[model samples]
Target: MSEEDVVQYLQNTPGFFERNPALLEELTIPHPVHGGAISLLERQVSLLRKSTAEYRGEFERLVSIARENEAIMKKSRRLILKCLSGDSLDDFAGVVEEVMREDFAVNYMSMVLFTEQPLDTSVRMASWESAEPIIKEMLAQSGCYCGVLSVAESEFLFQSQSDSVMSSAIMPLVSFEGGQVVYHGVLALGSNRLNHFDKEKGSLFLDYLSDLLSALLLRLLP
Candidate 1:
């Protein structure tokens, strides 16, 4: 029977009145059968109420987790800002390493600042050898602002890296002053699992990291 018809049947069934003595006395119609069907209908209603309660509980837990995560990110961003205020590049690197471990749970992370002249063609930037072209392309494309990129799964750049490394998140750090975009750097992260970074995941923390790095670079730049 259709669900609506079944509901109508359950509500009006004579057997329900017979099974439930309390209900039978209240009803005007006389019920021939004692309480069997009424008992089953009461059980169904109880189960529905229980299932709804469980779903609501789960939703509340999810919201709590999201808020906790947000608080963690805010603390991490504050630490990054403190790092940016340092006078030396070495101090910044140390802070970046610490932040990556605490915030992203990633083992390998690097911050590479670009120069007008190529440093060395042999040394791959941020440990990704084949990504030289990709990096060059991105710098050319974006002109001079902070941007985010996800590496392709099949890309050889990631596959050839250490076995512990599975994925990377690349964000360009840009310094803008008086409507002029001056310095650019890259923040790279390496994780052991392919699913570590993806579009589905929120990148709010990463955006904050990029801003902090950009501010540091602007201060350090000549």
Candidate 2:
């Protein structure tokens, strides 16, 4: 009989193995690892071992992610508290950069405010008319963007540190004025690692930060 016929027969007659139980121990299969033969029982054990190892690895990975998210939430809470306690926009800007560097290990960061009026803050200020078109395009596409940025885009956001940044995340700070949406500013974060802010990565945390910054800016704006 053909191999298919034999397989069909074995599947159809499950009691065949029980009737001739010796085959469970005597039948040999090719070893997956070393070049040798193993009994059917040994092959089954090997497969079970592999499956168990995979499940264990997946469990550990999930635990690691949970711990990482917990730490991030704690850091985010601290950042919010600091912002709330700030007396001025400059203080807010300084604390944000400090926390990003000290707590998040960010390589480079930029906070840009869109306004024509002179501001005392250390963060860059530009008129909405002079804002880069790419920034507008990015805001149009989504509230947050995470991925590798072009050299020109990096320069506009990161300035002198542009060359060092391999990947970045951008969040637009938006506010409402006279019932109309206003794109007030942007927060850009850069990392040296190529995949630190990969396109596929989730941006929920960044979006939360953006919302906080937008509220702060709206309150502090002159």
Candidate 3:
């Protein structure tokens, strides 16, 4: 029979290999490497070994992610406790900036709240008229924006450090009251590393950070 006929027959008869077990050992195929003939059984063993290695690599990646998340949880707890312990609202922004810069290794950080009434705090207070357009364009509909920033956006948020920033994670701080969403402000972290804040990275951590800030601001604001 032809080679195609042989292949078809082998496919049709699942028990053919079991019936003639010696064929599996005798059947020789070109080796993937070394350019030599090897038995079908040897080829099967090689494929299984490759698959096992791949599975092991995937398992290690998952374990690394779990460990990273655990570390983040610990740091977040410390931040919460320290903030709550502080006596005045004035220290909130300073605490956040210090922790994020010292522990998290962020290159730059800034917070801006859109309020007509000036507040005595480190956080920048501005009118909604100017910040509205920038906030809308930067964040769009997403709660967090992680990637490179436009020139205007970079200057608006980072100012003097704008030229040094390569990537950023920007979060819109919002509060829900009586089923309506209130856009309070923006929290941003910039890094010199090009891939520090990637677009593909998960934003769940940023979302939690924004929620914490919003809740605290709601309590501290008049």
Candidate 4:
């Protein structure tokens, strides 16, 4: 009989193995690693061992990821607490900048609010009247954007530090009250290393930070 016919016969008649149990001992195949022949039972054991090893490696990787996410969450909680402790926009900005420099490990970071708010104008912000078209475009996309920044975009966000920065992540900050945009702002991050930010980077943490910033900024409103 052909190999396919033998396989089909074996599958069609499961009782054959029980009836002819002695045939199992007779069955032998060339070993994959060793030069000698091995029984079918040994081959099956080898396959099981390989599968178990693969599963173990996957479990270890998952554990590592869990630990990393936990660490990141701890840092995020600290940042949120710091943001909430500030009484004014200037205080809030200081906390954000200091935490980002000390904790987030960013080369440079800044905030820009596009609306007239009751804060010191010297606190690194531009009102809606002063916002350029590029800023509007950034808000139009309306999410965390990570990658290399163009010359115009970098200049607009970083200004004096534009030439020093090689990569950037831009997150639009908007607080909504009943679907209406109340506070429009931008959080700009810069890095001297070209590969610091990539397009494929996950947005979960960035989104969380933006939400926290937006919530804290809501206190500025009337």
Candidate 5:
């Protein structure tokens, strides 16, 4: 057969190497890194080594992620305990902000709650009966929204200190009574670092913290 025909036949054939065991070891290929040729057996070994290394790298990445998640969850448990141990809503808010700054390395943290009537707040808070469109839009997001925010949004949340914030997260807070949302709040966290509150970061931990805070606040609120 012609060279083309032979090549085509091999492409269509399965187990051609197994059928021609002698040829498998008899051939040679140019080494990728070295300038010299190597035996077919050595070439196969090299390819296998490369593939094995790739798989090992992937396995290591997965292990690292698992370890990181485990550590976060452990810290989260402690945070939850500290939060729940508070004697009153004000105490709980203090613990929440303190823990967030110390454990999460946050630059700024504030809580904004909407209410029909004014209520005493524990931490830095803004109470509004009717919010601006920008504020309402953020609350309507339903959950955590993170990234570089607009000048208006930053100013609305952070006010005069807005200039220092490079990244921010706004977590919508809701109180459900009889499966209906009754009250809404916004938990805002900011950082000077541009990458601190990135959209790419997972929000599972944030959601957990917000859920705990919302539930606690709801119990104390009307």
Candidate 6:
């Protein structure tokens, strides 16, 4: 193939010698010297085409992955908007669970809200007895709130003692008006899989969640 033909072919290929001008120079070498009679132009063209095809495949695969990630992110953002507009706490909780399940692929979920200072010694928030210790510890530690994602070992230990949760993320809700504290509560989340609530995974979503819960708590106070 002629040098001009080779250059045009390379340019037409999706990912050919776009990076190197030197390759074009070698192909355009006007006079052939030495023993090799035929110009190695056709050989270079074949290699370039093969490399271009592989790169095009890789680029396409990356594009597919990016598109999938974008769709998931959009769905997650929509779920957050839905949570913000929910009419009631029950509605909010439902949306929260749905978002976790559908967007984060979380398998288990729960929430706990703190009560007034006199404390609602009357009842427990979760039906699971195993959670009582964690709740008690949180209360005693002056921890406004906490969320935990149990490691595989912790999950086994928890289950051995009682029904255990795999992963969790907790946040505290403190309600105040005119500098007077009205209520404090913890919001909890759980997932049945490992590393589901890692810091890097859902930090933005969790921050939004904390803000939503804090606003709701503030509204609940007199």
Residues 3-46 of candidate 2: C-alpha lDDT, one tens digit per residue: 99999999999899899988799999889879699999999999
Of the two candidates 2 and 5, the one with more favorable lDDT, higher being better, is 2
Per-candidate TM equals 0.59, 0.83, 0.88, 0.84, 0.83, 0.45
What are the runs in model 6 whose C-alpha is more than 4 Å off? 1-65, 102-104, 117-164, 169-187, 199-205, 212-222
RMSD to the hidden true structure, all candidates:
8.2, 2.8, 2.2, 2.8, 2.8, 10.3
> By lDDT, highest first, what's the ranking?
2, 3, 4, 5, 1, 6
TM-score of model 1 vs. true structure: 0.59
Q: Give candidate 5 regions above 4 Å deviation.
A: 4-20, 32-36, 124-127, 177-183
Q: For candidate 2, give the lDDT of residue 93.
A: 88
Q: Which should have the higher lDDT, number 1 or number 2?
A: 2
- Candidate 6 residue-wise lDDT at 138: 42
| Candidate 3 global CA lDDT score | 0.85
Q: Which candidate is the best by TM-score?
A: 3
- Which pairs, if any, clash in model 2? none
Candidate 5: clashing pairs of residues: none
Clashes of 1: 8
Off by over 4 Å in 1: 1-44, 117-132, 136-163, 177-183
Task: For each candidate in the order shown, give its overall lDDT on alpha carbons.
Answer: 0.60, 0.87, 0.85, 0.80, 0.78, 0.56
Show how many residue pairs clash in every candidate, following the order shown.
8, 0, 0, 0, 0, 7
Candidate 4, residues 32-92: lDDT per residue as tens digits?
A: 9877899888888999999999999999999999998998888888888987877787777
Superior candidate under TM-score, 2 versus 3: 3
Report the candidate with higher lDDT, 4 versus 5: 4
